[model samples]
Target: MSFPSFLSHRLSLVQEQQLELAVLAEHVKRGSGHMRRLALECLAQRQAELAADLAQVAQLAAPRAALRKEVAA
Candidate 1:
């Protein structure tokens, strides 16, 4: 149960990061000034990095969950 809960939390983090990146991308498209676009792009990149980290955490959590299930059986 804990492993499933942890995976769910990590997945939610990934979803949140992706949503932020989408918002940043919209700002990059609509930004009036060069600096604004540049800043938005940087933020989008950081969000992508965070999402990737969350994905890795999810992958790690998957095996733990499988092990726990097998142990219970």
Candidate 2:
């Protein structure tokens, strides 16, 4: 996909993850022992996924950014 489209897709994924985390946070607050544990686990997993997504974006962006700098120079 083109960079714009690729960024859009990633943005959506980030937004969805954010929403999921919000819901999970509520569950953690109100849930009992087992339920809270499950919510916390899901939250941790989601956070890791988000971190990976961000890292991938940065990795992809670095090359394009360097190309832009070369063009400008």
Candidate 3:
């Protein structure tokens, strides 16, 4: 199956954000003072973005999934 270019781009962005969140989590664990605080804030923002992207991906894929089910029936 092929995805629209925009969907592919969004998926890649989501993957990148997930990786960044992992790194930020590590920074939060080992960092201290202002740096740790900054990392925590960034983590929160990235988490929100990831949630939004996941929702968009789900919305885009829903129709394709339904079509597949209809074809199978």
Top candidate on TM-score is 3
> By TM-score, is 2 or 3 better?
3
| Ten residues in sequence with the least summed lDDT for candidate 2 | 53-62
Task: Looking at model 1, report the run of 10 residues with the lowest lDDT sum.
Answer: 39-48
Model 1: how far residue 23 lies from native, Å: 0.6
Number of clashing pairs per prediction, in order: 0, 0, 0
**Candidates in descending TM-score order:** 3, 2, 1
Global Cα RMSD, each model: 3.4, 1.3, 2.2
Each model's C-alpha lDDT? 0.78, 0.90, 0.93
Model 2 spans with C-alpha error above 4 angstroms: none
Tens digit of per-residue lDDT, candidate 3, span 1-73: 4587878888889999999999999999999999999999999998998999899999998998899999999
Q: Pick the candidate with the highest lDDT.
A: 3
Q: Write the per-residue lDDT of candidate 1 for residues 1-73, one digit (tens) a residue.
A: 6866867787887778777777777777777798677867788677769967876996788788889899999
Task: List residue ranges in candidate 1 displaced over 4 A.
Answer: 62-73
| Candidate 1 RMSD computed on C-alpha atoms after optimal superposition onto the true structure | 3.4
